[model samples]
Target: MSDPAKEYKQLKEDFVSNLTGGSIGEINLVTAIVPVSVLLWSVLQKRHSFFKPYTVNAFGLDYLINVGTVLLSFTLYSSQPLLLNALLIVPALAFYLTPPDSPTSRKKPDVPPKAKSKHGATATPDALGALPLKPFLTTYRGSMIVATCIAILAVDFRLFPRRFAKVETWGTSLMDLGVGSFVFSAGIVAARPVLKERAAGAPASPLAPRLVRSLRHSLSLLVLGVIRTLSIKGLDYAEHVSEYGVHWNFFFTLGLLPPFVAAFQSALAIVPSYAALAVVLAGLYEAALDKTELGAFVLTAPRTDLLSMNKEGIFSFFGYLAIFLAGQGAGMYMLPRNISPRPGTTKGAQRKTLLLTMAAWSAAWAALYFFATSYDYGLGLSVSRRLANLPYVLWVAAFNTAQILACCIIDTVFFPESYKAVDVSAEEEAHRGATSRLLRSFNRNGLALFLLANLLTGAVNMTVATLDAAPILATGILVGYTFVLCSVAIVLDELDISIKL
Candidate 1:
């Protein structure tokens, strides 16, 4: 009979939750039910097909699980951070331990018609050569990464699950914009090209058809966008405030631009070389004018809708757009499935690349750190949204991207081949062990661990003021709560809990 919002207020008094996309979040803001509903609907549509393998039903279930994990992570987030981190390690470990239901593990006749399934989204690679009319709707890595970013943004913006992170403007920018949104978005940038439409049987084009790629990207982001809005609604349930009209969600900007990408993809496809140069010029122009006192020169106006408008994402567009376009170009020429080891190559080139990326990132960071904190006028000015500060945005984007690329280089050095090798020397093994440990720290199972960490962190805050649970305890509960919550997630993820509710 008592109100939950009132109850939460009583418990903490000042919890900051700026939740984003709702379901899988727009796979973002909605409850676990939304993705299940979509997947079930898809399954129902195919049920009547005489040729519909019962296996397809299983794939639907997997989709449901993946989305469910997203849902679970947010639920855990509402509790604690450290607990959530611990909780995340479980499922990925289970996936590793489980006999990987390899692609060929079961044959058509052997798989119970109803039981055959796949874990990832429905990206059955296009057959040998022909381009599929519609690209795979889900399961594409790029779209998934994009969805992840939008979902997290939704979590930060729309919902007041735990508490808004109170940080110095710069610290807040670094934490929220830097590590959170920017880090995940970089993965999306790296993976974007992989999401493009590839014919079933043809030599893969350097770039996917722009329109198809854009639509695929946009549609996914849009669905996530709606969930983002819904998440805000949910946050209102717990913390009543009217943040509904604020339109600063970057997903909207991103979704809107895909059409633009599609429209221009074909034309620009011809002049591939100009793509990078154009983006660089545009970004510099946008940054200098909008991000500083000299912003007037670029003639870029900040957001000014009468009802509600944000100048962050779009106004600072050219900078990020440059990053994105540059990413696309890199995807076209740089990252690909086929990599060969040159005669003298044995981690030498990879190490060199990693070192260079570090050097660039470090140099950029020094310049940016000084410029970001010391400057009078910053990208912080918001015609659109405060969250999308241009200087902060570029600094984080460039830094994060550089870091990710460097990581990829290291990955290439160790992985030379995609699969794990049976025999290896101690030195190489030691190198891999360190990298693997680092990576496993944030791999997919990371969600479960993060949730668990949240709970433990909460419990710690309530009971003991270990250095770990200081201000976080400032909310409610204690480190003990953090421990228990994370314990649950770690157990669950490790078990690979298949329940889909």
Candidate 2:
């Protein structure tokens, strides 16, 4: 008789293989959970007295609405995403339409009139009227992390539909989106330090020192990559080698990026914009994949040596780097350089500039995605997460930019006064509700939460025959796993403990 362990391993491998992804519209709707959940929570805070009791002590409610609901959508209701979306939307709309108690309503304080300028407009105040982007960014990123954590282990069970698993070679799925989203999110945040360094006019350092500093910054990721490789090989864990390669993992991909980006910093200066640089890089890589034998080598070459063994990881690095640059461009455009407006710029002008920039960026990315993917009028390339090719990069950029835009719009529409251009004081920040605090916790301890989830996933796989578990049993296990992850994040945040490394 065949060994049960080997059979189980093979079964698991087959379970996630040879699959095509679902529609982009559906994926976008599923992603709506992030912003819509916040909107729903805000409406509840305003309209429901019954919910008021839990407002002060809302950890349970927070978990149920934010974490638990996401878990359900990705598992139990994975097939009926539209129904799931409707359930969330209907309640949020109903509650939002209802009038709030006068005592509970927060009215904006009146501002004293300022002197008029020569243009007959109110003199621009030092502080620009700009909505806070941090909360929206945090929510978007936290939700992505939460979804990744949930899907990592859930994909092992029958309850988690195969449609959501990572595609084999070319296609889209929730899991496929997760990997790119992680890279994109990292790129988005990575922009701040680089821009700040430029703005501060840091003294030019030698390349050797710069390289060393970049490597030092990335040391933890490299170390983790090593540890993960050793553990997987030592434990003989089941792995889909094609996902990265025989020896390579995503941590290595992430670890190597900072140094490569640093090396190219000087070259990048010649390019007018990071977005343009990204397009150039991706275009060149895609041309190489199509015009040369490199594409065949990545897809079908034998694993003869170390280089060939890890070709996918090595080659895909360029595509990921391009994604990173795109994200950096976005960050430079969106994030404020100073707390106040430029000397001569009015609040109205600043707001208009911000909106127009966001819109243009979104439109450009969307157009690129369509052109890259369309066979009739543009490059007829299929998206390949495995290759991290041009189409994949464009799709990720477009999807994320749109999501960011959506979140901003949602915040402006539902909580206008709160997210208004006026600077939010510490007092206003402190008065934020429990749901906001919970979302912030995820952002604060993001890496820690991801690591914990990975460890727990390994443990669960070793302890249980996930493929053999019944649907209800699998779901229960997932619920327990999610609770543990969220609880750890909340506790760490409450204790003001942030694990940077």
Candidate 3:
């Protein structure tokens, strides 16, 4: 008979893809390959006439830079091996390639539409359709988030990233990148209440209306949480071991915390609200994990298993709430005030204001991160999602702030007129080019894509013996998986269907 312990160890090694040394190289290759494949598909679909030098050349440059970054990361793994960090080069390239008059640049081009629709019916003035050629900074962030989430899911299930790294070891393991991208994006998105309200064309909501909306959103989260929990249990996959080691998947925390976060923000100002929540939650987590009777009880009260998730799992939501609230704080600063295109301010002036704000906030958060981590490093309190302590909060906030700075810099280089084209009518958006269609596909149905990917992860795990697939085969499978998922989002976009609660 096989030794279960030995069998288990091998299973884990295969699952995380660290079975072979130097799995980082493989992971980078997969990341580059998938995006490049998608870009190629977009090119084929758009079919800009073969002689269209500008469009074709721009896309070619993008593809080359993307692939080159992956290879460079792989080759330099010994010196600077963080592939995700290396991938940041793509945005830099994108920003550099965006000339003042380029369609992809921040400056709105005066060029006429490629052509009117066959039916000549006006298309709706949809932000989703505008995502492609003129993606805003936030749009890029959002797209990367979904893409990263999908990539990690593919890796964890052993379809790709066949060489894996442990989550705790740090240095941009696939698991951390996946979870961090999701959580980080969640925080930023949570910060956008003003923008959301304005976009919906509702007059600034009173507290009551906002509360009602928050509650509804919270209810949706709970329902989705239940669905995820039951779905995992039903599939007999809850017990399937993961890096988290706890009863909770990231989704569980995602579901349980958003409601509390929403309720907390209903009264407090964005920054102070999350700050206070973070303080309270972190304190509770520290205290509960102490060596006292209460701590012991808290830790052991609900023993966790596949069948019955631990109550301790719920406590982790406290940390997640802090993270979410912090994200809301980010949104308040990053997004335009009142979302009315800042009347009387030219786009240049608006960009300057945003850049200055991001710079100052980035500096403040960096200081917070340094101080908090210096104090907590000895106590094992740095960047722990389970604790969601001050250091973790600062780190996430600082990292996000830095990314925002990058976005602002990119915007300045590219010239952001597309995002500022807020007053354009619906008919104008419909006649947009292929790039918008592709970007909007992921942007509009983000939640749906996430849900679909989760469902597909489970399905793949159940049907395939993924733990030992060859790296090439696994990469191909993952690329195909992503393409299909992205296609779903695109099709939904075309049909103007968004799965929202």
Measured by lDDT, the strongest candidate is 2
* lDDT of each candidate versus the true structure: 0.36, 0.75, 0.50
lDDT of 2: 0.75
Give a tens-digit lDDT track for model 3, residues 33-108: 3344333323332333211232545444433333333333322332354454545545444543444233453333
Off by over 4 Å in 1: 1-172, 179-184, 187-209, 217-220, 230-245, 248-319, 323-344, 357-390, 401-442, 445-501
Worst 10 residues of 3 by lDDT: 45-54
Per-candidate alpha-carbon RMSD to the true structure: 15.7, 7.9, 9.1
Q: How close to the true structure is residue 217 of candidate 1, measured as C-alpha lDDT?
A: 57
Give me candidate 3's TM-score against the actual structure.
0.67
Model 3 regions lying over 4 Å from their true place? 1-134, 157-174, 194-212, 238-249, 266-309, 337-346, 375-380, 419-422, 426-437
- Position 28, candidate 2: lDDT: 75
lDDT of 2 by residue, 223-336 (tens): 999999999999999999888899999899888988887776666658878788888999999888776667767877799999899998999999999998888788776665
Residue pairs with backbone atoms closer than 3 Å in model 2 (clashes): 129-421, 130-421
Model 1: lowest-lDDT 10 consecutive positions:
128-137
**Local error of candidate 2 at residue 366 (angstroms):** 1.5
